[model samples]
Target: MRNAVLLPNGFVLTTDNSAGIGEKEADLVHVSDEVVAYFATRVALMEQWAAGAHPISIVLHNFSGNKNWDKYVEGIKKLFGEIAQPCPEITGSTESNMETLQSAIAVTLIGKQKTDSAEKYTWYVYGKPCVGQEVMTESDKIADLKKIWESIKSGLVESVWPVGSTGIAEECKRLGLRCELQGWDIVKSAGPATTVLLGIAKNRIEEAKLHFGKYFEEIN
Candidate 1:
């Protein structure tokens, strides 16, 4: 639940990530445009899916350059492929006229709500927090989006909260739950939602544990 707005049709989820990490002479982190876009889109898509909605359209804000547009879109498409879903309609602009020292991108996903049921659930976390270079080095720890989607579709997951720069404790506060995780790990940022908070039915806890394997951890 990064940023979602309720609309007559559905929830509009919007998320953006800007990094000084890119293949630019002035950039701090030397990464390709594709990698930047992939993570940026990942955050937005995670928010949409977590809210039980399927995206219908996408809006991209590319501050990198015009030359990076296709690569950025390819990065977005790659994420969709990972989830076995088609990329939605995309529209956006590039900052061609001005040169920026850092790589920045924003993504907005418009989705139609798929479920409206209310149920009591126990919360848990899947995946470990990773940021910056750690995101690529510790990619294996990132939560599997496809599996999460399946769990949600199967009704094992009642709701989801993607962890962001604010980390798990802040997200827990927003959900009105006391943070039960110990140490600094509970407060460290989960960049680009590498970790997620899942609300599962009490009876389905075991099933979810099996579904998530070593990545699963109870919040309380």
Candidate 2:
């Protein structure tokens, strides 16, 4: 799979790339996957709700890549701007120098927000690194999730002991984190998902969004 992760921070600045964010990584390949997955998932989710007819607003954290990130920013802007009919209110990060993986993660996580809409459910998808993609393991995922929750939540974050593969969802419950299975089937069956957007796309982006569903809902 793509092995991308999207950890959303409810009310923080996108440019807050501070050391206190989370674990920092220097690997470029890993960083790129994470950043791309983050943006792609967000875009896909918004596009679904936009229904190809309404405008979706989003604040993008334009970080990651290397010093040459700008060369590719235009393509991203165009992809998000042109694909959806209404398009997203995409914006770049306020910070300039985001060279590390941690910085990118921190920037994006801090900027995430949740809104209550009686019309439709609002889901915040938190991406997780796939197995074998990163040197990290379920232990690492849990640790990272805990650190993030501690930094954000005022009360004690729920705790879910590792119970095997199926226990993945339970872990989220304990940590108070959201799970993104990358497919609508799992997402839809899992419960009411405002948006089934996830970053860990291995075979296909739309296929991943299916989340155990029989057929994948292709993203436009």
In Å, residue 214's CA in model 2 sits off its true spot by 3.5
lDDT of 1 by residue, 68-165 (tens): 88988998898889888889989989999998877878888888888645888999988899988899999999888888888887899998889999
Superposed by TM-score, candidate 1 places the C-alpha of residue 198 at a distance from the truth, in angstroms, of 0.1
Instruction: Please name the candidate that would achieve the greatest lDDT relative to the true structure.
Output: 1
Q: How many angstroms is residue 11 displaced in model 1 relative to the true structure, after the best TM-score fit?
A: 4.0
State how far residue 122 of model 1 sits from its true place (Å): 1.1
Q: lDDT scores for all predictions? A: 0.84, 0.31
Top-scoring candidate (TM-score): 1
| Estimated TM-score for each candidate | 0.93, 0.30
Candidate 1 segments exceeding 4 Å error: 182-184
